[model samples]
Target: MQRVVSNLCNLLCSHYEITLISCYKANETLPATYNFPTNVKIIYFNEIYPDFKLDSFWDKVKFSYRINQLLPNGSKNILIVNNLLYPFFKKKNTIYIRLFHNSFENAYKKYLYKKPLFPPRIALFDKLIVLSSKELNHWQKLHKNIEVIPNFLPSIPKESSPLQSKIVLSVGRMDKGDQKGFFRLVDIWEIVQKDSRFGEWKLHIVGDGLLKEQIEEKIKAKNLQDSIILKPFTNQIEQEYLQASIYAMTSLFEGLPMVLVESASFGLPQISFDINTGPSDIIENEKSGFLIPDGDLEGYAEKLKALMQNQNLRESMGKRAKEIAQEKFSKEAILLKWQKMFNN
Candidate 1:
């Protein structure tokens, strides 16, 4: 969503002087040449040195002071916050929009306060932007200004080559084994490999993880390296989607992944383990993609193998996936929604 937000802000700047602020320290770095347009000014909030991990009252006091110091200098600035440094620094003219990526009521009630990184001031924004109707409804009961604007997709590439292989791809950080269902996917793959139903179709795992070495060990022990390809993370993810015929997701949960939107942009039909809150909103079951019951290992394999055996089914669903993404999640569509909200 960073790229989408950046691009949308740039588009908005044709009519307004927009400054993009980054509050969190980079979890990882991007190449410097990955540039935004020249008109856009990028500023990180670390100049005031907010204490990232507050272990004591002193740290919280210092952090609050630092945030007050770092609050932008203009009275009229539209402070679009991703649920950080909110309610701490109030400006009468500042239009604070809470971009709630996750932490819907279920997630908030279950995990927010327990996690060190959960934003404590989530309730103080002028308005909240969520991804789904379910989340908007959940927040609207407590807060009045909640809106649902789903994640945006970039324009589709002009040319898409025909699928050359029966490759099923799963993309995510492999670090949280259960979160992305990497371990469960591997276990299901193990069962599918031994069965005659899968034949020579391959499962390609993309993206890096903390469990890389352990996952490699498991693959080696199973003697399935020949049938499975494990790739490190890459910015050039479109290449994988272009080459593969299907996108497979086994996420136990999500905040509506941009990858699913991007996969649909590539016209790749998906086979996902439908857990709470994301896939059903995006997939539309067998129409655009196939969704298995939450964590149903047998169902995951059965559906994956079924799609693998039928090339016609893959093409039919993939076309539908692309169409849905183009209509609902395109960048222009989302920006128009934002434009109306900001102007109103």
Candidate 2:
């Protein structure tokens, strides 16, 4: 979300008077991880509520108060907030557009025990902006006004991978055991390795999280210490794509997975579970990549093995990936959509 905000503001700052309100301190010692244009103003509200936790509604109220103080009246301002909605979000004349970061069905599927609220809390905003059309259709069933504006690629590479390396790339934080599906990816890699032909291949996962130690233990248990490597989150993620021949993701769901789009920019053939929202939007099923059925472990391995064995097939699919990235996920294309939204 930080990357998204930074990139969006960088693009908008060229045309709009942009102010970036953040939750963390932005001082000499602690600055933003991503660079912001000089025109974009920065605000750090963390000090206002020194010790914060999501234990109660009053805690959310304090958080909202900080937000309100930064841009109290929304009369001429368009408040694009993803942080949290209200204990106090009602601002007169403000065009509130809440960014729903996850697929509509993603959280519900993960937490089946918790029934979803009718209409969902996103209805609190004047407009709800989602990343994919899949989720757009889902919420349209409720007759809520929504927009499908996918993520824009942060940068497009001048050179794509040659598809000659024996490495597979997967990038995302392992927030929990399942959200990004690194656990299932480990399970999938184990199956892919059953064929001795894949002996020299490597799986490079780049990201760090609360579950990092547990994922490390799982790799050791499988004796995949050498074959499967876990890399820390990187600022230069393009380097990972350049070093690999293919990309794969086992995510159960997504609101347009940026990694998949990033892979497309590097012209890497991808293999991913056809979850509720993301993969189908970017991949042309067998053209740019393969979209395996959810939980079809064997099917995923079979398709990945096919790509690993044939260089021609990987190159063909990768070429299509680059084309798709340019035509659909370009920054200029998405910025126009946002411009229209902001104008009227």
Candidate 3:
């Protein structure tokens, strides 16, 4: 979300007066992890609660109400509330847009809709921006005002992968509290390495989260240390894409996996479970990559092995993947949609 926000702000700031409002940031200096345009204004909400959190019900209520007082331009312009879909966070008569970075069904199934008043509170927003059409279909039934505007690609690489590397790259957060469902990778990789033909192949997972240690334990237990390599996140993710032959995503759910699009830009054949909203939107199935039936470990392993065994197939699919990403998810194409929405 930070990367997408940073990218959007950097571009949109040129056309509009963009002010980034961050709730948890304590100091004025923005985090070095993300860059911003010089002209964009930034509002940090931690003047009072420097270490804000919702550990208690009182804290939740406090944070919600106090936020109203701190918000800039209380009664003018558009307000986009991302991830937090609370009625209390909205302003009176302001053009509000709620951005859901996850699928509507899973979000409701998990927690947000369980609040009893939550479902009805969908009416509060003038518009809702979902990451994919899957959520668009589900959300439109409840609220008529919804848009399926995906995240724009941050950058396109000039160099594409040669597809000669024996590496299958996976990148995503695997925090202990995350729903990324990375444990499934362990089971899938275990099955994948059993084939003696691909003993030299490696699954290189590049990400950082609290679950890294626990996942490392599982990898150690399987005694497949030589087959799977875990690396920390890097700023040079495009280099990682260029070095890999295939991209694998086993996300339990996603809004839209930008990583898949990023991987595609570097001409890597992709593999992902047919999860809602994200993967299907970017991947062209057998052409760009393969989509295993959701949660089908056996099926996922089979397709991954097939990609591993054939360099020609990987190159063919990867070429198509790059074409789709370069055409569909271009920054101008996506921002044009936003420009129209804002103008309308």
lDDT at residue 9 of model 3 (Cα atoms)? 88
Candidate 3 Cα outliers beyond 4 Å, as residue runs:
46-76, 83-93, 110-113
lDDT by residue for model 1 (149-240), tens: 88776576654525558788889987754578787788888878988667587889997878877788888888878877899899888888
lDDT of 2 at 23: 69
Overall local distance difference test of candidate 1: 0.74
lDDT of 3 by residue, 245-286 (tens): 999999888878888989999989999999876899999989
Pairs clashing in candidate 3? none
**Model 3 steric clash total:** 0
lDDT of 2 by residue, 6-125 (tens): 789888888888877766664554334677777888776666566856577787767666666667453577888885554265555567777777877755343334635434554566
Worst 10 residues of 3 by lDDT: 84-93
TM-score versus the correct structure, for each prediction: 0.85, 0.85, 0.87
Q: After superposition, how far is residue 144 of candidate 2 from its true place, in Å?
A: 2.4
Clash totals for all models, in order?
0, 0, 0
Query: lDDT of candidate 2?
Result: 0.83
* Off by more than 4 A, model 2: 23-32, 45-75, 87-93, 108-121, 141-143
Model 1 weakest 10-residue run by lDDT: 27-36
